[model samples]
Target: MPRFAGKTHTAGHIFFYEEMVVIGAIFGTIFSVFYPFFQFYKWIGNSPVWETVYIILGQLFLCLYGFFAGIFVGCLALAIAEMLNSIPIFARRTKFRHGIGVVILFMALGKSVGSFIYFLKQLFVCGGM
Candidate 1:
């Protein structure tokens, strides 16, 4: 069998990195593309060719923006992890870096959710146009 096929080591790091990248990409793309699309589509409806054009153009921008956003966030987390790993207090635990990264991610996600909730409340309760 191949050496890495059986997962001798480094599996956790690999999984953690993959998860971070996926999450970053999703959040970035959603932020840049879907949020605006939905906001405008509510007013414009789904009948116009211009709407289609807007979405296509938006996706082009969002894809590139999302790709880089994901990379940047992932890199930042990795840097934080490295910094944490260097501290003597956390040297004993191998997963400490991942834990710190996850905590930071959750904090950011929680803040985003709060904003989304507020947006929904305003849109629905205030009778948005």
Candidate 2:
């Protein structure tokens, strides 16, 4: 809903911005508060107190980092999407910006897919720690 850098944002940009902020907050909360949940991936067989402390710290750090990351993500995602759509600057058109957007989109998609796969691996993998 905020104006960014003198440019009026489209609806998609606003949506992504909101999404990133929500995601960052959620992840931050999850990481900081439930850090020990990660132990499910690999129980270090260490003291429970230490694990609890680490989980709290991790969540705190994650929440703060996520807050910051959300702001950047909103801006960058919009910029990338716009460039991909070929909204040009300068009288002389450069093809580079347009192509760069495509690359960014694919990279984002790939990472997202990879992250989902990794999450499943951690979730459904057999055997005990």
Candidate 3:
């Protein structure tokens, strides 16, 4: 089956539709696995059995939060990128439409950079690293 639905009339009109959300969530979970901070490790350390369960649940909850946050930030960045692409200079460029793959590349790159900055800022602010 086709991944994208609906019609397209202009550049920046293409979207992942609802697919990006699901994809983002999957990526977020994958991201969580690689995330460096072990925020719950101390809390879970040599704990009572019940506390271990609670800590595990808490970690799961944080992972879920990260997942949703990733989707939210990605969608926001995409919307911002689309707005930039709508500017007359960009909109009028033939390559802008012809190279839709480039648009996706830039959008993903933008999102990655923005997320990294956010992660670093959070780490600094939380004094955890």
- Give each prediction's root-mean-square deviation over alpha carbons: 12.8, 11.9, 11.5
Clash pairs of candidate 2? Answer: 28-63, 31-59, 32-59, 32-60
How would you encode candidate 2's per-residue C-alpha lDDT over 1-129 as one tens digit per residue? Answer: 355623654655777767876997898789867877866526655677778978898999899879978977997898777665654452136645446557666878998998787776775454222
Off by over 4 Å in 1: 1-38, 89-129
What TM-score, to 2 decimals, does candidate 1 have?
A: 0.33
lDDT of 3 by residue, 1-129 (tens): 021233233334345545665787788687677666545555557558868787789899999989978967886777776677675466466545466657767977998998898786797566465
Give the candidates in order of lDDT, highest first.
Answer: 2, 1, 3
Regions of candidate 3 where Cα sits further than 4 Å from its true position? 1-47, 89-129
Query: What does candidate 1's lDDT look like per residue over 1-129, in tens digits?
Result: 122323456664666656776997798688766676667666866877978888899999899979988967886786767665565455345545446657656867997998798787786665353
Native-referenced Cα lDDT, model 3: 0.67
The ten-residue window of minimal lDDT in model 3 covers: 1-10
Model 1 poorest 10 in a row by lDDT: 1-10
| Backbone clash total, candidate 1 | 0
Q: State, as a TM-score between 0 and 1, how close model 2 is to the true structure.
A: 0.32
lDDT of 1: 0.69
Q: What does candidate 3 score on TM?
A: 0.33
Clashing pairs in 1: none
